[model samples]
Structure formats: C-alpha cells, structure tokens
Target chain A: MNLSRTARALLWAALAGGLGVVYVPLLIVLLNSVNADRTFGWPPPGFTMRWWAAAWESGGVRDALVTSLQAAVGATAIALLLGTMAAFAVQRYSFFGRESVSLLIVLPIALPGIVTGIALNNAFRTVLEPFGVSLGLFTVIVGHATFCVVTVFNNVLARLRRLGASIEEASADLGADTFTTFRLVTFPMMRSALLAGGLLAFALSFDEIIVTTFTAGAGVRTLPIWIFENLFRPNQAPVVNVVAAALIILSVVPIYVAQRISGVEATTH
Target chain B: MFWFMPDQEAAVRLIGLRKSFGPVEAVSGIDLEIADGEFFAMLGPSGSGKTTVLRMIAGFESPTAGMVELGGVDVTRLAPFERDVNTVFQDYALFPHMSVLDNVEYGLRVKKVPRSERRERALAALGSVRLDGFERRRPSQLSGGQRQRVALARALVNRPRVLLLDEPLGALDLKLREEMQVELKSIQREVGITFLFVTHDQEEALTMSDRVAVFDQGRIEQVGTPAEVYERPATPFVASFVGTSNLISGDAAHAVLGKGGTYSVRPEKLRLSDLDAAVGADEHSATGTVAEVVYAGPATRFVVDLDVGGRLVALQQNLQVSSMEVTELRGSRVRLVWNRRHEFAIAS
Candidate 1:
C-alpha cells in the first residue's frame, strides 16, 4: 500500500501530463478566437475581439445556434422519456428477449457513428420519403436522439438498481396505490437521476456531427455542421474557433451540473 | 373499535389458503383465524412459509386457492392498497428520499388528508415510537434502530385494522432487539390493533405473542398460547422446534416410562440425583452416565446417556450449584428422575 516517493512523483507527473494533453487543444482554440493573424499564425498573433463581434452579428451563426439548441433539447426530451421507460421495463420485469432489448438500446452508441448515420439516413429516406417529408431539423433531432438514448438509459438504470423495489412495496403496504406511490415516492427518489441523465443526453446530442451530417437537409444546419463547414473556409475559420469556444463554455454548465447532482446522490446514502 | 372490547369476531381469517410458484408450493393448505386486537406470532425457521403467510395477509400475494377474509369482508381479490392493513417489512423499507415525518404521513397523504392535520398526526405517531425529535431526519440519516421505529410509526399512523410485522427487529443488534421487543409489545397494547408478527426466533415469538403458530414446511404444526404450545406440543416437530425437548420413543419409551410409542420430556423437568437414588412412587427414574455438560449463564445442561438406550438432556438451575461443582459433575454417573405427569405424548 505504501508507494515510494519516486513512484508517487511519477504517478503525479503522468496524471498532469494526461490532463495537459487533453486541455492543450481546447486552450489553443480559445486563444485562436482572439488572434489578429489572418491565417492563425502561432507566435506573432496579436489579440483582438473582431471575430467574436462578427460571430455575434452573423445571421447564419444565429440560425445554426438556434437549430442546434432545438435539436439537442428535443433529442434530450425524447431520450429522457423513452430511456426511463425502457430502464424501468428491463429492470422491474422479466420477459423473453429482455437481454436482446437491452443490447439493441445500447447498439446505437456502440456502433461506429458513420454506420449509425448511414443506417438512419437510409431508414429515414425510405420511411419519410413515402410520406412526402424531406429531411430537416426534425431528422437531425431524430438522429441525435438515437445515440442519446443510451446515456440516459445507463444513468437511469444504475440509479434504479441502487433504488430497490422495497420502498415501493412499503408504499403500497401503507395503502398508497400504484400511481400514488409513484408520484409521492418513486418520482422524488429518481428526480436527480433523471436530471443527470437528461443533461448527459443533451451534451451528447450537442457535440454530435456525423449523424447530423447525414440526416440534416440543405435547409438545416446544426452548430457542429456549421463549425465543420467553416473550418475549411479562408475568412471564417477564426469565427469558427469563436463558435467552438462558445459551445465549449455552454456545454460545461450541464456537464458540471450533472457531475454535482450525481455526486450529491452518491453521498446522500 | 372500542379499546377494551377486544372484538371477538375474527379480525383476519384464512380459509384453505394455498400458494405455489410454478412448481414449488410455498404455502400449502392453511386455515386459521386471528382474533381482533390479538398479538399473533408466526414462529418458524427459514423456508418455513411463515413469511409467505404474512405476505398473503398483507395482500402482497394472492392465494392460488381459497380466500382471505378481513372482518367478514372477502379480500382475496384486493391489492395491497385496497386491504386495510400495513406491513412493517423486515428491512423497514422507509423512503430514503423523504424525511421521517414525511414517511409517517405518507398514508395520510394518499387518503388526501389535509397537510396540517397530517403533520400533527405524524408527529403523534413518531412520539408513540419515542422518536419525536427525529421528524426532519431522512431515513438514510438515521441508524438501523431509528429507521425501524420510523417504519413502525409510518405503519401505525395509518391506524390500519391489522399491522403485519415481518421480523421488524431482525436488523438490530441483540441488546437493541430485546429492548425493541418490549417496546413493540407495549406499543401494541397502547394501539390495541391486531398485530400479526412473523419471526424465526422462538424466544422473540414466545415473549411477545398472545398466541403463537409454529410453521413447518408450508403448514402449521401447532397453534396455541406460548405456554400451551411449549408444554403440550401437538406434534414432535412442535415439541423439538419451540424449544429443546428430550424425545424418548420406541423401546426406550417403554423401558424408561413403561410406555410404548413416543413422548417428550422437558429438559428442565428432569432431575439429577445420586447414582443409587431411590425413586418416589409418582416419579420415573433412569440410571445414566453423563456424556457432556453445557454451561449456559442461568442454567447448566447435562447430556446423559441413559441405560434405557436413549440420550437425555437435563437442565439444572445454576442458583444452587457453583460453576465449579457443575463442572465437576461432568462424566459422573447419575440417576435422572421426573414426575410421570410431566411426560406428554407427541404424534410422530
């Protein structure tokens, strides 16, 4: 159990090295947002807020931000409802092919993003094309929701496993019927888990690109797609960096809140 | 619901109740009645179907056959919520997310009781369990014993006709369990509600119950008062299960007591005397060699190998003998004597 001083020092060094490697690119993106250099020259770059101003004023950026927010929120809402139901069904009841159903739910996140995107694109084209519907923001939300379900499912499933059926049984024994027990006891216990799961599902949908690329029509542009397309354009790359910086800042709030909520849950018991 | 009337009508009744899970029959045919306001204990070992019976009473399990009647009402098809009963589960099963007051008030909330009245009644229930100051604490914030009291308060706040307790004190330590047993009995007396307690501990059942039913292998072996069941057990299983009994049967029964078939003699009833001690007219005597001595705190037990071809356990109170003298009696030859009237016939 006792680690040598040299070994402890080496472990600390490795952890710091890992964190530095992960954050260095993010730091560069933040720095490049303010760089005055036209081509993002590394050393001689002066500081300016012109790109931030440009990003704030651009109609395309505003529209894409709205679209991404709508898709992420819609996907997260659907994921929370479906994932919690699926978790409860699989956890509380036993039936044929239950294991297969669990595996199928996790398949979207397990498979390569390109494969899931292509499959969803093909299925959507066949199913919705027959109804005279073209791919739009709705298709993007659907695509994001497919992978997002797994995050919510895993979070809620873990919570359900920790919260056993005994309390619910006790509630019933105390003369509260099924719906009453759920409202008074079950929902309150699971509120934190649901919030954590929904936040994770929202974050997953927000950063997704491959599935969005395949499912979105010409009229729809999510923030990730907008960033990708602007990354190669000569005049708009710094503005793209500004948008990425803003997205990074926006995504941290939910992730941090999820971590805190789950942390509180772990300590409460 | 007059407190002292002790309603003689059956508070709970089971008529030919049976339950089976696929192939395993957990509870076979059972017919029983629990009088109103009586503290009835179902005593059995693990897998003895005692808990299954309690669950059936609580409406957690519907009988595969027969019916359950509560106060002349057939509740065989009712859900747990529909039944006018509450269960103190083995683990207490308090809502971890709610405060102790909230848990106690849950039943009232379900009935749409007004919030202020719910709070006052819940506080009163908590006071009955001697947990008044713990209203704001969550279940997770309390110890095992506190949680148990909270569960008791929660069940009592509903004022159900019957309270089914599934080994409510099983989780506490020995000292705490004994204290809670006394407290539970007093609480039951104060509440005057029918208490159907289920436990595997024989001493707990005997100490707390007005009537005890001994269960074995999905059937009731015997049902009687604590003393009646212990003294005059209807079956050999009951005689051995309720407490330690020296069972002498076959030729040994004939040789020792001039009886054939089978009989049970309580260990405490057997007396050890000098090797050549003369037996009185009303007493039966058997010469035996001491095989082992077990020193319990309040008494000393001697396992004697009888000359009549059976091993018998005789318990002597430690009040008269010092520990050294009891130890010296180990492996000594002795005569075991007991009055003939003390022996009871046990069905094999």
Candidate 2:
C-alpha cells in the first residue's frame, strides 16, 4: 500500500484535475448568475442579485417549472406501476420470451434519446391522429415513461431476485391469501426499492429535453425546453444562468434521497 | 405395518399422489397414511421427492394425480391458505423486515384475530421456543439458531392440525442441529399435533420421528419405525441410505450365508476377530484379509476382503483397542462374525 512521495503527489494531482473538470463549469454557472456584466464577461467587474430577482418574477419560468413537475410526476407514476409488474413477471415466473420481455423493457433507456423521441413521435402521430388526440403534455409524459420504466424495472427486479419466493410461500402457508400475502409480505419488502426507483425516474424525466422536444406539440414547454430556448435570447441570458444555477442546486435532492434509500437497502440485505 | 394403526383416524393421507415438472417426474405415485398426532418423517437424499410430497400435502403444489386428505377431508385441490396446515420452510423464511413478534403474529393478523389476543398468543409461542425477550429485534439481528427458533414459533403460533417441516435443521451446525432435534420433538409432543417432517439427515430422522418413510427416486422404499428401518431395511437403497450396510448377493450370498438371494448386514453388527475364530451354531462367519482400516474416534472400521469373492466392512468399538493396535491389523487375516438373525434378506 505504500507509495513514493512523488507517485502519491501525482495521484492527488490527477484526482483534483478530474474533480475540477466536472465541477468547474457548475461553479462558473453560479458565478455567472450573479455577474452584473449582462454579457457574462470574464471576472464580471461586479456581482448583484438582479438576475435572481428577474428569474423569480418571470411567469414563463414558473409555467415551465410546473410543466416539468407534472411530466416527471406522471412518468414516475406510470413507471412504478408498469415496471413493478414487469419485474415480478420476469423474476418470479417462467413463460415464453421471459428474457426477451426484460430486454425489451430495458431497451428504451439504452437507446439514443433522439431515436426514441423520433420513433415515439411518429407512432403517436399515427396512432393518436386517428383518435383525434394530439401530442402535448400527455405525449411528453408517455415518451418519458418509456425510458423511466427501465430504472424501476431494474431496481424491483434486483430486489425480487435477492428475495426468493420462500417468505411469500410461508405467508400463504400461514393462512394469508394471495392478495393478502402480496400486500402484507411482498409489497413491504420491495417498498424501499420502489421509492428509490421512483425518485431516480422522476429526476431523469425532470431534466430531459430531446425526448420532450419531439413528443411535445406546440404550446407545451418543459423546463429544460424553456432553458434551451432562452439560452440564445440576448435579454434572457442572465436569467437563464440564474435558472440553471437553481436547477443544479435542486437536482441534488432526489439523487441524494435515492442514494440514501438504496444505501439503507444494501445494509439491510 | 407396525407403525400404522387402523383404528385411529388418519391425520393426513395421500392416495396415489403424483407430481411432475416437464420431463422430470418428481413424485411418481405415493400413497401414505399418517396417524393422528404421530411424528412422521419423510427421509431421503436431495432430489428424492420427499420435499415435493410434503409440498403437495401442504397444498403448495397440486398433485398431478390423486388426493390429499386431512382428517378425512379431501384437500388435494385446496390452496395453501385454505388447507388447515402450515409449513416451516427449509430457509426458515422469517420476514427480514418485521420484528420477531410481528412475524409470529402475522398468521393471526391475516386470520383476523384481535390485536390483544394475537399478541398474547404470539408471545406465548415465542416463550415456548425460548425466544421471549427477542421479540422486538429484527430477524437480521439474530443468529442462525435464533432465526430458526423464530421460524418455528411463527409456524407453531398458527396451531395447525398438521405441521410440515422441510429440513428445518439442515442449515444449523451439528451441535445446534442435535439440540433443535430434541426441542422439535418435545414441541411436537407438547402441542399434540401431527408433524410431517421432511429431512435428508438419517440420524435426525431416526432420533425425532415416531415413524420414518425412506424415499428413493420418487417412491417410498420403506415406511416404519426408526428401529424397523435400520434393523430391517426393505430394499438395498434403504439398507445403505439409512445406515451403512454391506450388501452380499449372488455368489457372495451363497458362499457366506449358504443362500441364493440378496442380504444386508450392518457393519456394526459384524464382529472382527482372529481368522480361525470359533463360530456358534447360529452364527455366520466369513474369513478374509483386512484390506483397509479406518480409525474413527469411538470406533475402528475394517474393510475385509473375503476369501470367497466379495468384501464386507466390520465396525469394532475402540473400547479396549488402541489406535496403533487397530491400524497394525490392516494387512492381517481376520474373520467377520455375526448372529444369523442379523442378516436380513432383501427382495430383489
């Protein structure tokens, strides 16, 4: 384990270099949010809270925030429902194409987001146009759920595989019916995994832009879309920095919560 | 025949039970009747279909053919919850998320027993298994033996008419396994419930159950008291499985016993002495050279190659023999002697 002083020094330098590459840009965004220079000139010349105040007062930012929340929540709900069912089916039983079903469920997350967005856009137009339904917030939610399902499915599937069928069988032997066993025994065991998966799915859907852009029709603008659209506007540049800085701060909550839940699960196991 | 009592109502009966998974027939055809309140053990090696039969009786697995009756009621088609029986699974299967008390009371809660009554009963069950103060602890906090006791308490709290235990002690060490064997037997006696215990350990089967069924390759080779199965194995499989037995057949049977059928003699039943040792009128003696010697702590085993054609093992107690003395006899000529009654003829 002993290392020469020079080697250790080199390792420390590499570590610092790696971390700086990742966090330096984020720090710049926070600095630019308060940079009074409006052009975001290097060194700023001065700092102020005007951009933060402008972001808070903008109605467009508020509307985009609400739209992002709705899509994330909607996609997370659908993911939890369909993903858990699929995980159970694939983990606990044997039927035709069981492996293929799991692969298909996880495929959307592995696929390029733009490809999924394009395929979903065409499919929605073809299937929904006949029904007089058009792409909007609902289509955005559906599109996000396709990839979000992978997170919930992987989490629940791992949990189910770790927990064999014996406990559920014991419950049934002790007089609990099928539904009672699931509600009392099986569901409680997987509750943490579901929560962790839901949190990750929500975080993923929240900041997604490419899929949202293709699936969302005119009049629908999620927060990421709003940020992208306002990034180029001359007047909204400082406000965009404020919102981006805010997003960088807020994104830590769900990721931290998911890590804590899964960490607790790991220790319990 | 000695264990079966026709007058007493059968607690659990399997009539021509059969089960198959795809191409593998787990349990081909099993018909057995266990008496009320009897501690019955289904003893076999792994993949011998003992667990499958227990599962079918517990209603966890439906039989491919035939009926499972509990106290004169047909329960073959019933679900596990509908059947009036509970099982202690092989892994103990205690809920890792629940406290010990919660796990024991789960059955009562599912059955809609009142809170106070269920709590009192669960505490009593835990006390019976000697796990009283460990109620609030999670299963993860307990040792293997403690977890095993929790599983037992959980099943016993239900007070089912018939309790099924599937290799409940297989996970524990030797000392703990032996201790639990005595505890389980005592618990079965105290509850006055019919226990259908499944195990692959022959000694555990012998020590705990009132009667043992020796299963081999999806069929029951023999069902009798421990003494009956050990003293008189019905088949060659039972002879070797239940305990060590030397099989003498064909020419060896004719040469040793002056008979022409298969015979089994326990190694411990044969006495090793001088090659020219005198044989009694009713004793059968075989002259052989000691091929190998195994010096166990309490006993020494001698593998003797018979002069006629085959080999037989003789187990001699180390009561008076030293290790060096026994080991030196490895190449010496010896005679294995046993009473004529010790040799039981097995049907081919």
Candidate 3:
C-alpha cells in the first residue's frame, strides 16, 4: 500500500489525463456554443448568447427535441416491461437453455450498433411493409428498445439475485397468494432497481444516432439525428453547438437520478 | 394436556412423505403424527431432510409422494397461502422495505383483517417476543436478534393451526441463540400452538422440544422424548449424533462386553480412574492407554486407545482435577469403568 511521492504524483497525473481526454471535447463544444465566431475559430475571439437564441427560435430544434423525448420514453417503457420479466424468468426458475436465454437477451447490447441498425432495418422493411407499417418513430423506438432492454435486464437481474426468494416465500407462508406476494413484497423491493434501469434506458435511447438513422423514415427525426444533420450545415453549425451543449446539460438529469436511486439501494441493501 | 380430550385431533400428520429433487431424494419416506400443543423438533445434520419435511408441511414444497395433514384434514395439494400453517425461515426473511410493524401485520392484512385489529395483534405478538418498541424501524435498521423476533412475531400474528420453524435461531450467536430458544419455547406454551421446529443442533432440540425426531440420510432414525433419544438412542446414527457415544461392536463388543452385536455407551457414563481400579460384578471395565486429553473448562474428555481393539472417549467432570493434572494423564495407562446397564445394544 505504501507508495513514493513520485509514484502517487504519477497516478494522480494519469487520472487527470484520462478525465481530460474524455471531457475536453465536451468543454470545447460548450465553449463554442457562445463563441460568437460562426466558424468556431479556436480561442473564440468573443462570446455571445446569439446561438442559444437562434436554437430556441428554431422550430426544427423543438420538433426534434419532442421526437427524441417520445422515442426515449417509449423505448424505456418497453425495456422496463420486457427486461424485468426476462430477468425474473432467468433468475427465479430453472429451465432448459436458461443460461442461453440470458446471453441472448444481452447480445443485442454487445453487438455493434450499426449491425443491429442494419439488421433491424431490413427486418422491419420486410416484416412490416407487408402489414402497411413503415419505418418511422415507432420503428425507431422499437430499435432503441432492443439495446435498452439490456440495461434494465442487467439491473433487475442483479437485484433479484441479491434479494433472494426467501422474503417472497415468507410472504406466501404468511397467507398472501402469488400475486399478492409479488405486488406487496417482490415489486416494492425491485422499485429502485427498475427506476435506475429505466433511467439508464432512457438516457441511452435519447442519444443513440446510428440505430435511429436506420430506423427513422423520412418523416421521423430524433434530436441526435437532427444534431448529426445540422452539424455539417454552414448556416446551422453554431445552432447545432447550442443544441449539443444543451443536451450535454440535460443528459445529466437522468444519470444523476439513476445514480441517486442506485446509491440508496446500495446503502439500504 | 390437550391430548386428554377424547375428540382431539393430531395437530399435524405426514403419511409416507417423500421428496426428491432430480435424482437426489431429500426425504425418502416419512410418517409422523404430532399431538396438539406439543413442541416437536425434527433434529438432523445439514442434508438430513428435516427442513424439507418442514417445508412440505408448510406447503412451500409439495412432497414427491405423500400426504400432509393438518388437524386430520388432508392438505397435500394446498398452496402455502391456503394451508393454515406459517413458517419462520432460518434467515428470518423479514421484508426489508417494510417497517417491523408492517412486516408482522402482513399476514393479517392478507387475511383481510381490519387495520386496527391487525395493528393490535401485531403489537401483541411483538410484545410476546419482547420487541414492542421496534415497530417503526425497518428490518435493515435492526440487529440480527431483533429481525429474528420480527420474523417470529410475523408468523405468530397469523395464529395458524401449526407453526413450522426451520432453524430460526441458527443465525444468532450462541448466547443469543440460547436466550431465543427459551423465549420460543415459552411463546409456544403461551400460544398453545403446535410447533414443528427443525434444527441441526442436538442440544437446541433437547432443550426446547417435548419430543424430537432424529433424521439421517433422508429417513427418520428415531422419534422419542429428549430423554429417550439421548439416554436410549434407537440407532447408531442417533447414538453418535444426539451426543458423544463410544461404539463397542464386532471384536470390541466381544472382547469388552463378552457379546457379539453392537452396543453404545455414552462418554459421560464411563468412569475413568487409575489402571488398578476395582470393578464390581455389575460393571464392565476396559483397560487402555490415554491417547489424548481434551480440557473443556468444566469437563475433560479423554480419548482412550483400548487394549480390546477399539477406542473409547470418556468424559470426566473436572470437579476436583486441575487442567494440568488432566493433561498429564495423556500417555498414561487407565481403566474405563461403567455399569453394565449403561451399555445399550443398538440394533443394526
């Protein structure tokens, strides 16, 4: 455990270096949002709130924000439902291919996003086209849910494994039937885990672009897709920086909420 | 006392109970009847099927083959909620998210009891366990012993026909465990409910229950009063498991007892003395070299390597002997003497 002064200094330097690498670009984006120089020239010659005002007044930005919220909320709801059910089935019971089921459920997240996007794109076109359902916001939500389910599944599965079946059995022995035991005992115990998972799922769906790009048809446009489109436009470049900076700030809310909920769970457990 | 009623029914009964998880049979075939108001203990080691039987009775597990009856009514196919029995799990299993009062009142609430009555009964149950003021605290906020009491109160509030306790005090420290053992027995007596307690601790079983069933290898080895099981074990497994006993069998039985079958002599029964100790006509004595000596505070145990082809453990109270004196007896020749009546022949 003993470390020389130089060694300790080196370790701190490494940590600082690593964090700087990850956040320096984000800080630059924030700085450029008010850089005033429309070209985003290094060490901005001046600062102004003109870009923020422009982003606020743009109807395209507002529409993209609403579309992103709808997709994230829809995807998170589906993830919470399907993921919790899958976690319970895999954790609580023994069946053939049970291990494989967990692996398969988690595979979507481990896969390359572009691969998932391409596969989902093809599958939706072939399967839904026959039913007169085309790729749009619904397909984007479905696509996002495919990977978002992994977060909810992992969180709920870990919670269930830690909680054990004894408390539920104790409830049943006390004369509560199956449904009552789940509602009264199991569900309450899983509430914080569900919230944490749902938050993470929402955050993931909010910023995902590759999957959204493949799934969203001409009429659908998520905030990430809008940012990607406007990032290259000569006139909308400063406005995109404003939107990106705003998103960076907004994204903190769900992550912070998830961290607090999981923190509470850790202390209580 | 309840047995004196002519129309009284047995509190719980199991007929040909068998449970198997895959290829491993946990409880082979068990048939037992516990009288009303009796504190019954199923005592065994870890893999001996006692808890499995208790689970079957509680309806947490359905037996692979057998009938479980409560008050002469067959409830073999009933769900745990439908059965009129509650279990205190070994881990206490108090609901972590609920306050102690809510945990205790859960059963009553599930049964649709009025809130005021449920609270009153839960408070009373908590009072019986001597944990009255702990109602508002969550289970995580309480100590192990307090959580145990909450679990007890939770089950007791239901006032089931029978209560199954599966090694409920196994998690407590020795002193706390002993204290809860007495408390549990007293509570059982006060409620006049049949208690089917499962335990791996023989001493706990002997001190708490009116009758104890010794289980071994998925079968009941013996069922008797504490005195009967301890003083007169029905099988070799019971003799050694219930307490320390020296087995004199085969050549040792013939050489020591002038007999051929197996016999068990309790370590405490054997009197240890000098090599030249005299034996009466009613006494059986064996000459041996003290192989080892264990000083256990109040009593010193001597492992003797008998000249008659076996080893025997003799427990002698350190009433007058010092630890140094007892420890010095190792490697010395000694004679183990016991009355012939102390040797009980075990039927294989």
Pairs with backbone N, CA or C atoms under 3 Å apart (clashes), candidate 1: none
Candidate 1 CAPRI-style tier: medium
Better of 1 and 3 by lDDT: 3
* Proportion of native contacts kept per candidate: 0.89, 0.87, 0.96
Residue A230 displacement in candidate 2 (angstroms) = 1.6
| Stretches > 4 Å off in candidate 2 | A1-9, A41-47, B1-7
Local accuracy of candidate 1 as per-residue lDDT tens digits, B241-326: 88896899988888887879789889999999998898999998889999999888899999999988989899999987787889
Task: Please give, for residues B47-157, the per-residue lDDT of candidate 2 as tens digits.
Answer: 999999999998888988989999888988899999889889899999989999999999999999999999999999999999989999999999999999999899989
Residue B223 accuracy (lDDT) in model 2: 96
Task: Rank all candidate structures by their DockQ, best first, as comma-separated numbers.
Answer: 3, 2, 1
Enumerate residue pairs that collide in model 2.
none
Question: Each prediction's DockQ?
Answer: 0.76, 0.85, 0.90
Model 1: number of backbone collisions: 0
Q: Kindly indicate the candidate among 1 and 3 with the higher TM-score.
A: 3
For DockQ, the strongest prediction is: 3
**Cα-based lDDT at residue A19, candidate 3:** 100
